[model samples]
Target: MRRGAKRLLLGLAAALLLSATAAAGYGWMVYRQAERAAARMYEPLAPAEPPLAYAAIPQPTRVIEAGGGLGTAGSGQSESAGRAAEPVSGPFAFASEARAQPSPEEGDPFTVLMMGVDERAHDRGRSDTMIVLGVNPARGSMLMFNIPRDTRTELVGRGTLDKINHAYAFGGVEMAVRTVERFVGERIDYYVKVNMEGFAELIDLLGGVRVDNPFAFDFEGYHYAAGEIELTGEAALMYARMRWDDPRGDLGRNARQRELLQRLLQRLVSLETLGRTGELLDAAGDHVRTNLTFASMRGLALDYGARLRDVQTTELAGRGRTIDGIWYYEVTREERDRVRRLLADQLR
Candidate 1:
């Protein structure tokens, strides 16, 4: 992972933690505040035109009910049609008829593409961090992995082979999502994008996090002992940013990021943090963007939160290569296919 990649993964971790706050069973006032915050964070991606190569790939078919459950395409009317007949209230308000009528014993399996963008003034920066998560509440498990930012692949909408992260820089979230869907050979059910710069503030608001350092090292004037330790926002930022001193280099830094992420997630979901809903939502509203509606989030929390206890993670294998005097992470066809199958099985 490079500097931008490291920064974005932190943003992803914080965004996920804050998003889970919607399921904490808050009172009406807190729920209303969450609804308002969700409204600010909502930025739906426009429909994308698939690339030529992906024309034959059978994309997954799913109808997202207003209540966030999965239904067949012919199960009911469109969400927009349902909205048109009713007065819009809060973000959670949905017409009763449009709600999903899934089997009581079944659980919806869905995929999410989470991106950390390195946006700056006057530039729609690249997706420095790209991760895919497959959640199956019925199995009480999840599949997750990261796509290296420097990987060379088809840029989808742009019709040229280039670094995968460049899709965001060229066409924003729509193109990024299109490119990734083609890469994984599946349709992404939802997306969450976060600007990396705001991640530190989010960590601070959560009262910091705990990480088990594998080795004792000092970077940017912060000394970390080799054991379980607590870090302030700034210290944690530095902790994830150091790679040169690490013998494993980017790989070591990546592991640290994952460890820190797990810690933050545990802290966010704990009973102790439930009282700080307003502050958490406020921080998230400023830095996060997603297509998930408030109603859907609440439904997921209530329905799937308890069942989703087992988590599994894997890495996409690739090797560094230089092409035309530029460095890129090149993944083989076999490797890509293996990952696609893993995701496909999870969804099934």
Candidate 2:
């Protein structure tokens, strides 16, 4: 063979190899992007999370001896305050008590209560905020709506409504879950409750999130415009709570809140955060609490590889009404019905 022909052949071989490598790299990038998106969509229970009646809760519900079950009793009370022996149903305040009789539907789709509590050193303050999320894979939609804390009605355990958030503080986790179930007339398959402390940390971990301000406003010395900007966790938290600056008040905060959640999911599933899975999980485990076990979370997380679509958020309407000289957000019958129907459609 001629020397020129040999050189030409070698050049052709190199070009072909480079083309193959480039194609593979592009494909890998696409796969990774999709994988992250799916992970974000999976609001799964943790491996430690048990069904409503199964797992143990965090607090020592009642004091007892070694080898004694929850119902067992000694000098049932905490050592310090001598707080009357808590009913022997919870430690972590598992949803067990709420599941004395389980929901009619066993999460064929899935139901979750996204709760944010105000926690101080010595006291687990009330569930200051509550957002219920009902997701249906079949319908490919999600429903989220809020229940104001002060709205009085029938409480779950005591069957009297004082403040919705008080349920958790009064009876712990199980009580809060049950109270929500009774209020919505829906069974809660799982819950994720976290304190606001780690909110800022998670945002910084995900490289911050982007949000749009409908109108420009000054908040806590930070000015937000009606455009996109990267937000730190503290900024985002502050943004979500800035109802005073927003003309629309809580409704505006609610919109921003949902926007924050959606973007967080998107960023969570992006390639930028792939190598940081352990860190993300650690942040979540420390900040967020849920009954979903490791096994359940894995299974749910695996399901993320399937589809990427915009999540659906329900728009809830209610009037702030005062009863007995106190104020509460009261959902009208029509609005309540609409939420139920929307939830059912998504769950189906």
Task: Identify the leading candidate in terms of lDDT.
Answer: 1
RMSD of 1: 15.0
What's the C-alpha lDDT at position 180 in model 2? 73
Error of 2 at 347 (Å): 1.2
Report the C-alpha lDDT of model 1 over 242-292, residue by residue, as the tens digit. 878899775666667666655665576566667666887877787788887
The residue-by-residue lDDT of candidate 2 on 1-348, one tens digit each, is 111111111111111111212222235653344334334433444222332321111122344444864432222322233422232222223322344422312223677777777676889767766777775544445566666655554455584535677888887677787777655656677776665555566557667778776777877777877787777756666677676667776666666666665565555445576555545544444445556443344333334312324377765676454334455554444565577667656565
RMSD (Å) of each candidate, 1 decimal = 15.0, 17.8
lDDT value, residue 286 of candidate 2:
49
**Which residue ranges in model 1 land beyond 4 Å of their true spot?**
1-24, 49-106
Candidate 1 has a TM-score of 0.79
Each prediction's TM-score against the native? Answer: 0.79, 0.67
Worst 10 residues of 2 by lDDT: 1-10
